[model samples]
Target: MQLENKVAVVTGASSGMGHAIVELFAREGAKVVAVARRKERLEELVASLADAPGEVAAYPGDVSSREVNEGMIDFAQKTFGGFDVLVNNAGIMDDMSPVGDATDEKYEQVMAVNVYGPLAAMRAAVNAFKASGTKGSIVNVASVGGMRSCAGAVYCASKAALISLTKNTAYMYMADGIRTNCIAPGGI
Candidate 1:
């Protein structure tokens, strides 16, 4: 059990990669907090993993809010009696609009979920890691478009910002033994 006894909080955990991560973590014996806005989906995920080696709890909320970001982290610590990893996987995509075609609303919404949410979560996680003296890990799930021009302007920009945030966090928190990294996964 690679994650035996570990406590992890995974955002956007109702579907896709987030969903899979939650399952894998629990299978490996980690206590996982699966967070997503879709209550039914989260409940389903928790129920499906009922017989896993570890435990899973559903936390229904929007990651775009600072409160939700902080709340999930707090919940993990309070519920599992420890905190070890935070996976920031919640995100939204912008329509394939170029810069001239991008709307302020689109940019704001994208940035809120893709960048700001992770930033807030990282801050909260670092504080928790410090208080607990645990060498922690933070995984920010980005898109390959962040490193290239394959995606819409707003989405690319949002993901780029997230990648930068990850690098900065990794450097800043290294001394504290809290590792941070970004994963820019993509598919056709």
Candidate 2:
């Protein structure tokens, strides 16, 4: 088990890639905190993984909220006794509207989920890692829209910001053995 004895926080964990990632982590013997807005879905996921080598706990909340982001990390440490991994996977797609057609509200909403949430979580995780003296790891889910103009303007820009944040975090914390990475997936 590559992740044996590790404790991880996985956001967007109610469905899709987040759900799959949580399964993989638990299968590898990591205690995982599955986070999402859908409480019932998170409960179902936890129940389904009942016999895995590790464990999964549900933390239902909106990742767009800074408090929620930080709270999930704290939950990982308190529940599992240690914190080692952070997977920032919660996100939402824009309405495929160009900048000229997008609303201020849409921009704020997308950016809050795609970028700000991860930022706050990363900040909280780094502090936890430093305090615990654990060399932690972080994974940010970016998109090809970040590198290309394939998606709506708001989405593309938000993803681009995440990608940059990932790079900056990796560079800033390398000396502390806190590694960070991002995956720029094209599509499901």
Candidate 3:
């Protein structure tokens, strides 16, 4: 197993890319703490992974909250021993409105979840690794929209900010045994 004995935290674990990453990580032998907003769905996800090589534990909450972000790390440490990987995969898209047509609420909501959420989670993870002297891996899921301008104003700008954060984290923490990288997937 590529991640035998590793413990991971995956946000947005009830659907889409987050769910997929949790399944893949479990198959590769990394115990996972799945974070999402839907308690029932999160429970279902954990149940479905019952026979995987590793394990899955559900923690339902909104990733945009710093407490929720830090709580995931604490759950990993308390449940699976320690944290080694974090997949910052939770995100929301805007209404595809141009900046001129966008509302302040949409802009704020998208940025809060996309940028600040990941930032808070990664911060907690990095601090955990530093304190425990553990080498860690952080995978920030960005988008091609982040690099270009395909997804309208709020989403595009939020993703762009995510990409920049990923780069900065990589450079800032590489020597500390925490390697950060981003995946800017195109389309599906």
Candidate 4:
């Protein structure tokens, strides 16, 4: 129970790496607030964690929305007392296309989910951490595609922006006992 009595909010918890992180956090004994757009899948994930030391609750909403991020954090604070960690893992990858051929829709879609989503979540989490006066940790999931240029221009740029955001947030909140870090997975 490394995380006994701790509460964490994990975005993108409906699938992929997000799902794995949520499961691991629950196993570590942190009550998890799982956020994702797919309500059914979130419910299934919660059901699967029935025996975990920590409980899993679902908040189905678009992570790109500021309102949703704030609401999720407020809900977690009310439900579990306060938040000690945030896993900013929600993201999306648009169809691969060269810069010249990329559609505005595709770019917007990628930025909205992959960039703005995490920004909103981080903002809400940092405020909560400061208000609670707790030492908190933020783990953002990025990609080396941002570093190596394998992903399309827009997608790569979005992740690179996230990397910068992580660093800046870490620096800004260090004095308040908040730590922020990111993992940039390479290749597929």
Candidate 5:
């Protein structure tokens, strides 16, 4: 779909892959709502992308929090009118450890940021897309850990669940003109 004049919400956009995606989307003429936990980093990114085809606004908040995710979407709609795309890219990888050595805290942290975070964002985006009556796309950044068992046990399991959620949501939302897809990146 043409990205010109479109509105995109990208989580974890302060740094890493999320930042790159946000920059590219803006260059492609999509007004991007850059969401991340670090307000300063997001501001820097926005400054660097000032000359891009489309504009960008930074929304700093933790993606793992349901209130934050909902608020971000609401802010984006108020700012851009409606939503067209969502990039569920916020994630955190815990220290490599076997299942036997994994701590409950580590597991919970990883799942909250990497798995539940994206799910919450997707729910918000779906509602916005339906309300806008526009064809929408959701791009989830999963990991090779999801497709294979090579990653640390807890991380792998979280990503695998994310993959499953992506596919299921894709199937369920196809009839609604909303497309959901995932990218499983390998090595980083």
Candidate 6:
């Protein structure tokens, strides 16, 4: 019951690390708003957690849109009473294309989901926490690739941008009681 009654929003909640985080949070007594592109997967996730101590609501949407980011925060607050945590875990990888081989579309897509989306979500979270006078946490899931050149150029650049954004958010909002940090995990 460490997070009893806490509310959390997790992106990319259909699979991978995002799914795992949502389950863990629910088990720890945190209500979760699960955001993902696949509606069926989200439903399955919710169904599988029938016995968990906390609750989960599925939100089907792409993480690349600012509107979606804002909507998730709004929905969390409206549905569960508050937004206590946000996990920006939605990200896309490039196709191992080098700079010369990378297309504008690929680079833009990577950046949109990996960098811009998370930034939008974090901004909305901070604003909500500020207005409510509540302390909160934001966790942006970056990659080891961001720190070193281990992936395609576009992916590395997108993740690097996310890392920078996370750091800046921490510095800017720490005084306001919003703690932000980036997790650079190795390949799963």
Identify the candidate with maximal lDDT.
Answer: 2
Clashing pairs in 3: none
Question: Residue 132 of candidate 1: its Cα lDDT?
Answer: 88
Worst 10-residue stretch by lDDT in candidate 4?
92-101
Error of 3 at 86 (Å): 0.5
Ten-residue segment with the worst summed lDDT in candidate 2? Answer: 63-72
Candidate 5: C-alpha lDDT: 0.91
Model 1 per-residue lDDT at 90: 91
Taking all chains together, each candidate's TM-score versus the true structure is 0.98, 0.99, 0.98, 0.97, 0.97, 0.99
Worst 10 residues of 5 by lDDT: 1-10
Task: Give residue 163's lDDT in candidate 3 (0 to 100).
Answer: 98
* Total backbone collisions for each predicted model: 0, 0, 0, 0, 0, 0
Residues 131-187, candidate 6, lDDT per residue (tens digit)? Answer: 999899999999999999999999999999999999999999999889998899999
Clashing pairs in 5: none
Q: What lDDT score belongs to each candidate, Candidate 1 first?
A: 0.95, 0.96, 0.94, 0.90, 0.91, 0.95
lDDT of 1 by residue, 1-188 (tens): 99999999999999999999999999999999999999999999999999999999999999899999899999999999999999999998899899999999998999999989999999999999999899999999999999998989999998899999999999998999999999999952
1-188 in candidate 2: lDDT tens per residue?
99999999999999999999999999999999999999999999999999999999999999889899889999998999999999999999999999899999999999999999999999999999999999999999999999999989999999999999999999999999999999999888
Candidate 1 has a TM-score of 0.98
| True lDDT of residue 70, candidate 4 | 92
